[model samples]
Target: MSKKIREKKSTLFSLLFIAAVILLTLWSLSRAEDPDKLIKDIQNASPVFLVLAVLCVLAFICLQGVVIWLQCRSLKLQESLWRCVLVAFHGYFYCSITPMQSGGPPIQIYDLKKEGIHISVGTLIILMETFLFKVVLVILSLGMLLFGHRLMRRYIWPGLFFFILGTILTCGIVVLIYLSMFHSGLLRRLILWLFRKLEKHHLVRSKKGRVEKLISAMDKYRAAAGYFRNQRKLAVLLLAVTMLQRLAYFSTTYFIYRSFGLYGVSYWTIVLLQAAISICADMLPIPGGVGITEALFQVFFRDIFGTMTIPGLCLSRGITFYAQLLFCGIFSIAARVAFRVDKSRLGFFQTSFIVPEDAP
Candidate 1:
């Protein structure tokens, strides 16, 4: 772990990452089916219907912004909920376009900093919000897997048990490490000993450090079980947000199917359709899930569409993916320009920024 060896390892890793990026870029471009057809699919959306869909998406983004703002305020930021919502919209617009579902926070952080929030607080809020979001997603996913989806309902009881056990075990390990390494003197001594050795090899430097500064700031209101520690309540609220998101979308799909003359589709059918489409689209990993999502809807609804599979699939996918993505990008541009969000581009979380010494 000397400087020379570290340099060599870094170079090797960089080369590997670059090679992987090149492969992915190529694989993605080569998979593009037809430019004209994609255009048609997006344009196939009626202007009026598309406008309505866009409004729904806007509402979705605003709700997310509000929740994030509330969370930040609870964490002691002085930003308005409305401003936060606009930032959220801009962030989602970017995350939607990029792979790994990243983007949204850094831009908002920069904007908020201009409005007087310390950059460090902005960064902290993003991390906290993301942690809450993920916790909610996992809980909701577990619920859906247990009782919501028919496929899951059949085989997932045992799977559910195992999943819960796995989650608990993971949490136990993490808590153990946190308690032992950071909060316990004996464990802290062991960690420091290791760090010194590693430091000699130029791996980790500065054994004497107050790592708890970050942890204590986040746990600022732990005595009152302030917002940061109320993960369960936050998870519930975020679960509601997550459910609203899924419900609005599936309901829209049901309406779209009706518009297309597929009558009498049940509530469960919509859930099934949305779940199947989402699971498949997520696996694709392409920005917006593009071709993968469309193909999924088509395959899932093939029975309903009969021989008109392609158009039927495109119709559903259009409402969910291409159309929504286009509207998000357009609205994002409008919101950014209208509200003067800096950078014109942003991401999910702010990784670095300044902080007032006494803010926390």
Candidate 2:
């Protein structure tokens, strides 16, 4: 296909997906029972807890930036913390809008390119971030499931199927990443086999150039993986930071739980339930997992919040997802504008910052 035709089709698909997300959002809102009571509960919610919830969201965003910034710095790249934060917001904005966050990494790589980071390096950074995030989430979710089995049975029994499926899918992704990084030969052979099978079935045009490009990308990814292999301490530090990042986001629900003035449920219990909800929601191919996340939240927290479930849902989704979407959208736009202005004045040049295969 011609480049212009491909672009047009992509745009059309994005528009349709956005329209679907809007409809889903409306449907989710329609599921809320007793708007009057929801509003009353909101009115009576503690302002302090609400503020803390907002801060937790902010921390989540900023800490992700910290992770990115630290990665860049570790590689001797000169990325400012503020710019990294903008990149983080840019990622969140695209991820929220696209199915299963499929758009986030490409746009984020583009954003990093504008900062003079090479495409391979940006891809490596994103891959590392994703690997750590998934690993942390899976570990935490499994631990919760083991220790909090009773809680899971009581609150999330209905969604057990989804929880299990999500866990398996998440583990599959982690294993794939590990194989791609450490066992590239096997992954390459598997990929080539699949490609040949597809080509034989006439599913894809026999594009030798595409295969060459894929091989080239994999070689670069393996080279980037070497950096982590040598820098074990940095790897550990990033993993620790990732754990804190996940916890910061998970804590939002607990604060929202407190905001409703309901008690008897411990903080860790709420955090674990939120973690479970995320595990179930992450694998769904929905934009921001909008309807599904809200539904899961209502299902899991119904007993805990009792009559205030709807209000808690409103507050939680509003602050975490909708508000986040708005703020990240603005930040991403601002980042784009800044990049353009800088390019106009400085004459932007593409530069490659390849990580050395054997660096100290």
Query: Best-fitting candidate, measured by lDDT?
Result: 2
TM-score per model over all chains: 0.59, 0.84
Put down candidate 2 lDDT per residue, 1-360, tens digits, no spaces: 997698558746765776686676656665656667667789999999999999999889888889898888877776778988998898888788777777777877877777766566677788788888899978977886788788877988999988998899899989987777667678768888998899999999987598887776666666666766778898899999989998889899899888877789998889988999889988778777877897898899989988888888888988988888889989988888864313322221122425322211
RMSD of each: 8.8, 4.9
Cα lDDT of all candidates, in order? 0.52, 0.79
The candidate scoring highest on TM-score is 2
Candidate 2: list runs displaced more than 4 Å.
Answer: 1-32, 187-218, 340-360
Root mean square deviation (Cα) for candidate 1: 8.8
CA displacement after TM-score superposition, residue 124 of candidate 1 (Å): 4.5
Q: Score candidate 1 by lDDT.
A: 0.52
Candidate 1 per-residue lDDT over residues 1-360, each given as its tens digit:
697697457446543543465456336533543546545644554555545554555566676677767656554555567677767766765555554354455666665655455454565455555544444434445556566666444433323443344345434444553343234445445655775677789886544444455344333212212233445676577657755655566555655555444566575666555554554343233555555555455545656545444544555555565566566667667665665433322222212222333322
Per-candidate count of clashing residue pairs (backbone under 3 Å): 6, 0
Model 1 lDDT-worst window of ten: 345-354
